[model samples]
Target: MRVVSLHSPAKVSGISTAGARLSRLPPPHEPWTPLLIGRALTDEIVRDTPLHDAPGLALCAWPADMSPVGQVLLVRERLRELGARVVIPNDLYHGFVAAALDHHRGVRVGAWLHAEHHDGDELFERCAPISDAWRCVSERGLARALRVGAGLDIPPAGEICPACVEVPPACAAPSVDGPLRLVYAGRLEKHVKRVMDLALLADELDARGVSFTLWVAGDGPARLDLARAMDTHIRAGRVSLLGPVAQHDMPALLTSADTLVLVSLSEGMPTTVMEAFACGRIACVTAGCGGAVPLIEHSGVGVVVPTGDMRAMAAHLARFAADR
Candidate 1:
């Protein structure tokens, strides 16, 4: 069956990366087409082109400036033209559109839970009546979905589809005598990502005299602010911003670091952490990083500190630096 994965346009984000990978699946799996909405057709990134190197997986975008009814109508028309049998909406707006069109147009609607947020809960609740299926990025998300389903008297049928990355051949581990190499690869957003907290962590580490280097990758609206916040560290060569690294280059970037750091205010499951693991690196994440907390605790491969505890994070880094 032809499936359409609907999401917003993001240059370097988990949703965009996952959508691009889904679109590249070889035969035997259902073919997926990624459609980016809520952006203007004239936007430079909205062009109808294959996303990255994914063959036949053209990226499509639609404008969001239209009226709600008009947006729904346009989506319906486009889906009909694309002959989409299954519609997987990754965001709330598109989820509503798919929910509205599911029964009316005989298309199967699947709600995608990529994060643990009120918006995700609201989408599940609103679309449960008509949603044919649901998938979540982490076990926490799946459990939440099940809880919601139980409350609504719906059957628990959500699937856990965690984010993935290709594991390359293991590279030689970095020298233990050198400074601890830490990296953060994700959108540099302040709200959910808590990037400003990362700045504070940098300050804590510097104040503690920890021998470490932090490489921050990716870009977002808060990039300028984060840069300003880390100005001292950046000038001191302790922090480097490698803005918006390409997907293909991620494995090397991850392998170069000894530990991956994520101090997000929230997450469903971070692909960056998975990529770091794939590259044989440990992680040091905050409790607010969602599913990663338990994974790290149980697996004993990483460290987890309470959310916003920059001093604790710095303490751990200092220990790693001194012990290594």
Candidate 2:
């Protein structure tokens, strides 16, 4: 199957990594064609790639900053031209439905939802008119979708399509020989990822007399706060901010640390968490991270703390220090 993937231009940097991993899937022979937007002339890259062929399928992902109505129109037009089906978020489909007073473009519509808010049932009921199939990444996601679809009177056309881990194998695991090392490997932001929780954990660890090292990867608005917090730690030789490292250098960073950490306030199954797991490195995650916690717990691959709970975080750090 030829699948056309829609994602933001920011993620285009990792296309080679994503494509390489997808190509290795023992499969129904499905390959991906990534369609990136939100960058300068990204259409050129899309047109030049081998994925522009006809008779393919389209998969829209990363619901952030998405305009479902505009995306649906684009998807509909592209599907008609390529003879491909359109798969997108239920939210996107709802937008399409609103603008589609003229009727949907008659292409099969699938909802690929990974997470939901408490009021998702009400939100999804709003899309009964346009969705044909539904896919959720986890059992919780499936339940939420079902409840919402049922409430909306949009009986699903089939069973759920579970989300899979798309993380690539880290070439090596970080060696745990020196100071207790903890690394955060995703974008550093406040609204979504609870990066502040990590900062607090560092403070807690220091106050508790725990000797360790903290390495932060990626960059964002939180850099200044992280910098202020790291000064004392850096002076004490306890923390180091590597800034935004390239995606390809991630495995090396991952393998360099004894453990990985993320205190996200919300997530749709973070790719970084999966990469940490795949590297066989233990992780320290917050409850705000959905779905993947169960996998982490089931695999005995890491520790989970209540969202924003620095006390619990400190305790976990103590454990890691003891074991180390």
Candidate 3:
């Protein structure tokens, strides 16, 4: 049998590399294939398209951003074309698979969870109907998968895939300085990311006579508000708003600062924290945010403060900054 896996080829170089690696494997008894489709799946789709040389089952990473519904439709159609079953990387895909199964009954759909998180239950409840099997990356993730399946009112029947930690190559250490080098990166928006706390913390530092240089690395709806809060610093060059740096530049950007801070109210295992850990930098993150609690405790990599507690967060930043 030939297996085919599908995902977007744009904006996810990591996945593309992994897909290319997985695609070269000889067809297993239960074949698998990786297909990069949808918008921007290739640099020049008309000229250079990477095609699978064999046949097999189709696995998916669930690229449902724009035209999410259409992607599901296409997957369903392709399954019919190959007379093969559908496989998914996570419960996020279960929802899409459920929708596809609603339109095309008798199609086999399965799940392969990459991590264990509290959101497992929610995902299964929303998309476990077409799921005929389950898979996970670790024993913990498998336990979560079992719980998720049970919560979906389904019996357990899944496998565990080996887990791989994404560690970065060894790099030079970050520079420590007297003036606290506070940095905040990621989306800049009050309604969604609520990253305004970075600016407020900078203002508090100014008020408390603590010298610091705040680096803001993105632009969003909250930029004006953050700018207004530190108008003087913005003009004096103490606070720099370098809008939208590339992902590859993140290591250099983070290593330049003494402490990496994120005040986001919501997230899902933010890669920022991982990136910080890989960079060997400490982080000041929001407590009970997404699933960072374990990482914070296990790695001794950083601190976790209550969401929107500017005073407490500022205090922690002060200590961390002073230590550096």
For each candidate in the order shown, give its overall lDDT on alpha carbons: 0.78, 0.60, 0.59
Estimate candidate 2's alpha-carbon lDDT, on a 0 to 1 scale. 0.60
Model 3: lDDT to the true structure: 0.59
Off by over 4 Å in 2: 11-28, 39-83, 89-106, 118-129, 155-176, 234-237, 243-245
When summed lDDT is taken over every stretch of 10 residues in candidate 2, the lowest stretch is: 8-17
Best by TM-score: 1
lDDT tens per residue, model 2, 263-322: 877655566677776666788888777666777878888888888898898888787887
lDDT of 1 by residue, 1-324 (tens): 778877666667787677777877777887578766664644456432224444444334455567777777777777777788888877646545644565666788876778787767877776766677777888888877777667674435756788666778766685588778999998888888888988999888888888789999988889999999999999999999998787778888888888999998889888888888788889999998877888899999899998889889889988988888
Output the lDDT of residue 232, model 3. Answer: 86
| Candidate 3 vs. true structure, TM-score | 0.64
Report the C-alpha lDDT of model 3 over 60-164, residue by residue, as the tens digit.
Answer: 333446477776666566655655545443334623463356445555555555444446556656555556665554455555556666645554656555322
Ranked by TM-score, the better of candidates 2 and 3 is 2
Task: Give the candidates in order of TM-score, highest first.
Answer: 1, 2, 3
What is the number of residue pairs that collide in model 2? 5
How big is the RMSD of model 3? 6.8
What TM-score do all the candidates reach, one by one?
A: 0.92, 0.74, 0.64
- Give per-candidate clash totals: 0, 5, 15
Q: Against the true structure, whose lDDT is highest?
A: 1
